[model samples]
Target: MDRPLGPVPAHAALEALLPPTALLVPEPAPPWTAGWDERDENDGFRPDWLQVRRLVRELMPTPKSVTRERMAEAEKECGALGLDGLDGGEGDFATLWTTRTGAWLAEEIFEGLTRLCDVMDLEPRLRDFAEEYVRRGMTVEAARAFMLAQ
Candidate 1:
């Protein structure tokens, strides 16, 4: 008769699927870090800047309060004034939001990227370099490539 699969067999399967250097169980948390738990308790309350950017981009194709024709007309007038497109306006919106809210989206993104770098034991200088690249009108893909090269 075939043996029934049990907890031991399941655990063995999980172990085999993981990296060879992986621990079977999590390590115990340090007592000294216990107080740091509350530090991130309010993390959920922070706005997701990535999602905000996406929403703003989507709204760009459609005027928020104006009619489509009026938006097109306004775009033509803005172009006559040397403006590129609604994207330029969205950039201004991002700047305004960051200034008003006391939280810059790019700074938050940089912080998250640096934290990930820390976890991977990689150099943190990429964050500042990326900021400079973006400031110089480099695309995000270009910035990422520059960072990865570092």
Candidate 2:
């Protein structure tokens, strides 16, 4: 349901500055774009550091030449991701990926499933059958069969 903004007045100015042959396609606005009209002075949500870095990195080839306009676009994208409520902390994709795979055993998997349920506000159940199947080092399909038998 989200849509990016279309070309703006500044884009026209930018196009004029460039060579006539050079293509000047305006970048798409962030998904949850908001206006700064007087009636709604609040610009809208702000993305966290991680989200900003990711968006910018995805758009630009290198981080050295980031412009104010590009930064604004990244911020808007972050808002779309529901990052406004997050505490201001500088984290990147590396941090998230590094922390996600500390455990691989059955106990760890069981614990992770429990945590997932908590986050989703779902009722937790003791998945003993699944745990036993995992402990035996069976393939996922076989484990599922064992679980069904229990």
Identify the leading candidate in terms of lDDT: 1
Query: Candidate 1 — worst ten consecutive residues by lDDT sum?
Result: 22-31
Candidate 2 lDDT (Cα, 0 to 1): 0.35
lDDT of 1 at 26: 21
Question: Against the hidden reference, what TM-scores do the models get?
Answer: 0.21, 0.24
In model 2, the runs with Cα more than 4 Å from the true position are: 1-48, 89-150
lDDT of 1 by residue, 1-150 (tens): 023223244233322322233222221111132232333344533223333433333445322333444445544555565544333335543333223121222223334453454345444444455645344332334345536644
Q: Each candidate: RMSD to true structure? A: 19.8, 21.1
Window of ten residues with lowest summed lDDT in model 2: 96-105
Model 1 earns a TM-score of 0.21
Most accurate candidate by TM-score: 2
RMSD of 1: 19.8
